[model samples]
Target chain A: MTIGLYAPGASALHRLPAGVKLGALVAASLALFAIPSTIVALAAVPVAFAVYLSTGLGLNRLILELRGPALLLCFVFVFHALAGSVEEGIAAVARFAALILLASAVTLTTPVSEMAALVERLLGPLEPLGVNPAKVGLAIALAIRFVPMIAEEYRQIREAQAARGLDRNLLALVVPLIIRTLKAADDLADAIEARGIET
Target chain B: MTRDVSTRDIVYIALFAALMAAVNLVPPIQVAFLPVPITAATLAVMLAGCLIGAKRGGLAILLFVLLVALGLPLLAGGRGGLSVFFGPTAGFILSWPVGAYVTGWLTEKNWPRMNAVWFFIFSVIGGIGVVYLIGIPWLALVAKLSLFDAAKGSLIFVPGDLVKAIAAAAIAETVRRAYPLMQAAR
Candidate 1:
């Protein structure tokens, strides 16, 4: 809910190692794409939904999770319908939707920290390739942590612009938003340095 | 041009990536004429490139994309997960890092001479042109359309993207004058 699909459940999926879950998602996606049958893809949709339900995240959260994909699925169907046969279009949409559902279920059960740890460990072998997985993981954590705060700032900026009747003025809105964000970053840097984190 | 990345650089990278995600809070405006809705997230991508430099800017976007792939709804319209990589929107999302890198490269190379006009030019070139170059073909393939048709359909994004470019330029200029990190990479 913060910035990830994690639902903080105690399901078997939640207990699985992050790497294994990710690997399984990738394998499942490949398998879905490898199959060419429309009926098979459509039939798999229920199985995908079952995976989500198995996590015990509740129907409401599942619905919320599916909202974005649902809209996009409609768009995909419409485009494919116009360009090709409706049957094929449905197949394409079904395949994509099932894959998304399964992947989302994995994420819904896995924590971000676990994923980061898995990534860092996985990239350990790539140290010879000049890849600093620790730094990358830290960057990812910070990005995830800061996204919600910055989104609140964005919402405030938009509301302020709309209040001033300059909401339509893209420059007016963007300039202030950038200025504020830069200032906040500067302050954050100073705070970090003061805490002796790094220079 | 290569210096050890400091704590500040790390924070900046994270913050810019956060900014990229944050812009999605500003709901996409749907112009009835366009198939693709206009979102401020792309503007933030350009800002990340122009305000930060090539390496950090590109890394920031790469970070964002990675999160999206991990099933974070960081994209506009709350879209996320692995399926996004296989959809029509895949091209633009995949192009983000390269697009940011190109924009940052052009901006930093021309830092001394970079004015609002130059910022606008670079943003247009990297943000729109580069993104479209790859995005159109991918869209064509995914949607089962000809390249020309894909290009034509993309025209609807032009006016809005141009506006975003101008806005990004104005902001980038202000950040340069105030924060002056434009020359950090050099």
Candidate 2:
């Protein structure tokens, strides 16, 4: 449920360079998907779990992060079992769960700013192509920062609607939510301009 | 084709991205009669496309996807990360930007003159039509099912999506009327 998956610690994974962690994730994901063996995929799951355990966030945070994916994994397994073969089902679920756990591990260890820096570095080559990687990185940072704010706003709107007994009205709920959100966006735009971010 | 992205535009994109993420915080509406669960996040995506024009709308969704790929639990029910890209729902997730783009493009065509009917038509075309076009095939491939079967499986989403489209159209019209700045440039 937490947006910022980074868990503070002095673990080796936390110490790994953001770029390296990202690169490893890409490589590992590719490798997992490229190899179609069920046994290898199943083996990767424990390896991923072990790496996640090494983060020292304990099982609670891991489970919280994994809860949604676990539901999805069930659907995948069921679908594959019903529509495909048993081997295929295991292979698909294992590969998916393994990749998810590994990714969550990386996120749990790496801070968002580091990730943004990595993104900026990766996009550096595109400067000549007229791409502003800083802008992209800033956008990502802003999104992460504002996600909780928006979530809060949604809650506030819901509460307001409920107070007025208009909660059941879809239009009553959606209209004000959009209007208020857009108003918030306008204020944010003013704030950004005041700070002199490139137009 | 090149336009300067103002700080305002960047803020809009970020906020819309946040808005999409926030929509997920709300529990999904479950229909007692139907086995499928309907999420409001997709409606936020459609509303975003209609609110901002195509380029900005698409960028908003793109930024959201990038955050998701980087392992932010922003998707519905706090789901995120690269593993989502490999799942059966990957098609729908990946089609988000294209769907937003198409919806925004259609909405922009009639701009100031657009009414509820136009909004409804454009929203459904972009939200339901474009998303389904790519999503169904991707579902079939990832789920290893026949195209027809994939389409059949997707039917459960239709009633909910149509309702969202209608809501989007009405909301778009209201915003366009209430705030002139929200309207497309003629």
Candidate 3:
């Protein structure tokens, strides 16, 4: 859930401009769509993982990070196989895995601060369109920061609900979470205003 | 009221984002009639808007997308990355912020206190329309189907999405009443 990239060392990949890394990801993604060989896409998985490891990022951490999606991929593959050809289904699954790993590498190398700065710079042209680059940058940064926080809060809420015997019911868990989140948002607004971030 | 962002506010934003991501980790609700799985993540997105208003709600979703893009399994069925954005379900992913914005905008405009009819209209036209507008075209492009076919496939989602929207409105209004601070934020 943590959206912040975590690269282990200061390396060339880490030093690269966020825009360049983002561009690389885009180009790689487009190229991935072009190549239909499921085998080649499957091969890219190890290569991407190698890249992550070579950069000093831990393999264990990466696997742990991928566990949730990996499980989801399994379900999708099963569903796809049931619905379509096994060959096509496996191919689709490989493609998805390859894309995720590659994208993760980019994120792992780039810091959130640099990402925000890059986004602001990219939006410079939008100033003429009446857009505020700083605001956009701040929004993106906060979003990145929020990913993990929301996840943790959900865990606590779920536990609380479970203890109260409400975990079995979907509405019981969801309603309280929503209410808590709304309350948090109001507090955030007050904080933002008080900080004079709006001004 | 005119003070800087407290540490608590920062914590709240972080908490909301994380919760949104966690919900994505849950198994999607399987629908017997459709290929698309029903997930509560959309409800979380709507909640973000209702609580944080348009700007931060949009920010929260953007964060969620970034996490997915970064290879976190923080999506329905635990899917993530740019590839997901190009798949059949991509449209729904993209429509998230727009849905949140619509929900927040409607709430801001006094729809929160209205009768069920207006509430239904506000939630549907605003929340569902935003999602469909982005989702339908993307589904068409990915599936290599005609617009009508794509629309038809997506139609299967309408009933479920409507349910989520109403749930969102009800939750939003209830919170607004329970915690006066929510309404006072605006």
User: Could you estimate the TM-score for every candidate?
Assistant: 0.82, 0.85, 0.65
lDDT of 2 by residue, B1-186 (tens): 023666677778887888777767566544333233434556766877888878888889888887877767667666776657766678888888888889889877768678888888888888889889999998877555568767877888899888878877877888777765444222
Query: Where's the lowest-lDDT run of ten residues in candidate 1 chain A?
Result: A166-175
lDDT of 2 by residue, A36-78 (tens): 7889999998998898888888898877777876776676567
Candidates in descending TM-score order? 2, 1, 3
User: Across residues A158-179, which tens digit of lDDT does each residue of candidate 1 receive?
Assistant: 7887899866665565567667
Q: Give the Å error, residue B82, model 1.
A: 4.3
Winner on TM-score between 2 and 3 is 2
Candidate 1 has a TM-score of 0.82
Off by over 4 Å in 1: A1-3, A148-173, A183-199, B1-6, B23-39, B81-83, B141-155
Q: What CAPRI-style quality would you assign to candidate 2? A: acceptable
Single out the weakest 10-residue window by summed lDDT for candidate 3 chain A.
A1-10
Model 3 chain B is weakest, by summed lDDT over 10 consecutive residues, at: B1-10
Compared with the true structure, model 3 gives a TM-score of 0.65
Each prediction's RMSD over C-alphas, in Å, is 4.0, 3.4, 6.6
